[model samples]
Structure formats: structure tokens, C-alpha cells
Target: MNIKYSLIKKEEDIDILQGKESTFANLHYKYNKETIQFLKTHFYRQDSLYLVATDENNAFVALCSLDSDWWEPHHFFLREIFIMPSYQGQGIGKVLFEKCIDHANQFQAKAIVTETAFENIPMQKLCEKMGFTRWDNPQWKEGITYKLFL
Candidate 1:
């Protein structure tokens, strides 16, 4: 498969990135209108970055969204990263994550942070493989936070 990676640019790309059968719909939004609106606001932000991986046919296979931390100016937070079920074991997620790490490094970010539910072993394993350690803090209790220092 000829997979290509690129930063999100057009409105249509956002639509394609938000696939119809996405399991992340609840976290992002179930409706296209709301998703588009949210993307518009965040996609253009100076401190935010969004990347997508597409197949030879230009169909989105994965996506990663990140933004600067609100309280920590030098830290970047990975908001989302998803790979289509068909493409999950093909290393697309790892490629997208590497892109996020590159983005953080390019921006001179001190660290990259992300959060995932305790039951999501796959994500936890990915985080660990990426050299991220669990971030323990009292403020966050709903999920575990992972941090990778640059």
C-alpha cells in the first residue's frame, strides 16, 4: 500500500479525516456539522497541528491532532490519534505518532503529553513503546496521562 502522510489543509480533508464509521465519533462529535465547526476553530489555531495519513487512493487511513498545553506553554498535548480498523496493524498509527513527535520537536516543545483510559491496553502499550511514562497528578482521575520529554 502506498501510504502518504500530510498535514490537513482543506475543509474536505477534514471531512475525509472524520470517517463515517469512526469509533472516535463520540469523543470528537457524531455530526459532520459540529465536527467541521470544531475543526475550523482548532485547525487554524496558531498553536494547534493536525496531520493525516492517506492511502494511494487518497482515502484517510489515520489522523493525529495536537495542541499546545493551556497551562504549560512549552508542552504540547496530543488530543487524538486514530487509525482505521483495517489499517490498525499496518504501522500507520506509529507513523502518525512519529509525525506528532517531530512537530513537537520542530516547535521546540519541552514535552508531549496524551491521555487514555485505563482499559485501553493497546493505547497504553503504544504510549510505552513511544517512550512515554505515566504522568501521575491529582487533577486528572478519569484517565491516565502519559508524557514524553524532548
Candidate 2:
């Protein structure tokens, strides 16, 4: 599949975004308008939100967001990373992840952090595979948080 990358700018991309949200149950929202408004506002900044991959038809297949100012003014946070069901298990997540890592490096970020709830084992495993170690605890009973030096 051809993977196209572009900045999500128009309102129509919201529908494609909502459709892709099914892969991430944490993103389930009762009202899409509110969800759109929230994400559009908080994630529009450059280097924060990015559509890193698209399919042969130019439809988005994988995407992610990085919040650079969360922990401190200089640290970049990998807030949200999602790949469509059709694109999962095809190394799309890794590509998107590496892209975010490059973004962190470019920003001169000291560290990159990401969090996932207790139930998301897939994410936890992926984090471990990506060389991220647990912080604040070992069991991760509260939640899974990962940091990588940038």
C-alpha cells in the first residue's frame, strides 16, 4: 500500500478520523462534534499532531500525536498513536513511532513519554519492544508510562 503523509487541515478529515477511532476504544465519544473541537484545538500545533501514513487511495492508515510541553517545557510527549485495523500488524505503528522519535530529537527534547491504560497490553508490549522501560513503578498496576531519551 502506498502511504501518503499530510497535515490534517479540513473538516472532512474529522470523519476519517472518527472512523479510525474504532481501533482505539479509549477514544469513544458520545458527541463527535465535541471530540473534533477538542482534538482540533489541543493538537493542531506543528510537531504535535501528524498523519504519518496513508493507504494506496491516499486514505489515512496510521496517525499519531506528540505533545511537546506536557511534562516540562522541553520534553515531548507521545500522546496518541493509532493505526487503522486494516493497517495493523504491518509495521505501520513502528514507522509512525520512529517518526515521532525523530520529531522529539529535532525539538531537542530531553525525553519522550507515552502512557496507556492497564488493559492495553498490545501497547505495553509495543512500548517494551521499542526499548521503553517503565517509570514510577515496575508492575504498572496504575497505568503504563514509557520514556525514551531523545
Candidate 3:
């Protein structure tokens, strides 16, 4: 299936927040109301990217976000990455993540950072497969923190 990727602009693509329901490894997932509001208020801004992918049918299928880090000025943060369950295991997520790395590199990011639930094997595998090293971030232990130095 053909897929299109777009870099969302401020004040645009808010409807993506009304994303589809999905599940992975027994975890129920969706762009919930609180997530939508938070994204609109904190993520829809300059110097950040909200990449959304749609299929030939024009239905949203995947998404990944990258933003320059405020805490680590030279690094970029991989806010989130997700592929619709129907679209998983098809390499779309990897391609989308590669695009995000390119986006971060465009800004000369020294590294990229992301985190995932410990039970999320797919995410952890993806991070490791992408050359990310599991970091011992004392500040967070509920999950795994990954760092990819560019």
C-alpha cells in the first residue's frame, strides 16, 4: 500500500489527534483526550516535527514526533513513534523513524533520545536495532531510556 508522510505545521492537522484505536503486546493504545490536548498545547510549535503517515486510502496509519531538547540543547527528543497494528511488521515504522533521524540531523543534533516501556519488546528492539544504547537514566526507571549519538 502506498503511504504518504507529511510534516505537520502549527495550527494544522489537529484532526490527527482523533487517531485510531490500536493495541500492542496487550497494551491498549490510542490518542486519548489528555494526549490530544497536551499535543495541541505543547507540541504544535516551531522547531519541532509531528510526522504523520497516511495510506493510499488516506487513512492515518502511523506517526512519529521529533523535537529539539530543551534540557539538552544540542540533542533532539523522539517524543513518540507508533504504527497502526494493521501496519506493523511492514517496516513503515523503521522508515518513519529514519526520517525522524534525518530531521534531527538537519538541526545538527548531537544525539537523539527516546524512552519506552520495559514490557514493550518491539520498541526496545527497534531502539537497539537503530544503534541506540540503553541509558541508565537515574531520573527515570519505570522504563528504558535510549540514546543514539550522532
Best by TM-score: 3
When summed lDDT is taken over every stretch of 10 residues in candidate 3, the lowest stretch is 10-19
TM-score of each: 0.84, 0.79, 0.90
For lDDT, the strongest prediction is: 3
**CA shift of 145, model 2, Å:** 1.2
Q: lDDT values of the candidates?
A: 0.77, 0.69, 0.80
Tens digit of per-residue lDDT, candidate 1, span 1-150: 799988787646777644344343244323366665675666766868888888899876777788884466699888877787788777777777888899889999999999898677778888999899999846788989999999
Model 2: residues with Cα > 4 Å off, grouped in runs: 9-15, 23-31, 137-142
Per-residue lDDT over 89-123 for candidate 2, one digit per residue giving the tens place of the 0 to 100 score: 77777777777788788878888888887777778
- Residue pairs that clash (backbone atoms under 3 angstroms), model 2: none
User: What is candidate 1's TM-score against the reference?
Assistant: 0.84
Give, for candidate 1, the lowest lDDT window spanning 10 residues.
22-31
- Number of clashing residue pairs, candidate 3: 0
Write down the TM-score for model 2.
0.79
Pick out the ten consecutive residues of candidate 2 with the lowest summed lDDT.
22-31
lDDT string for model 3 (1-150, tens) is: 798988766544745756567676776677876776665664644668788889998888887788774477788888878788889888887887799788888888899989888878888888888899998877789989999998
Error of 2 at 129 (Å): 1.6
lDDT of 2 at 115: 84
- Measured on C-alpha atoms, candidate 1 has an lDDT of 0.77
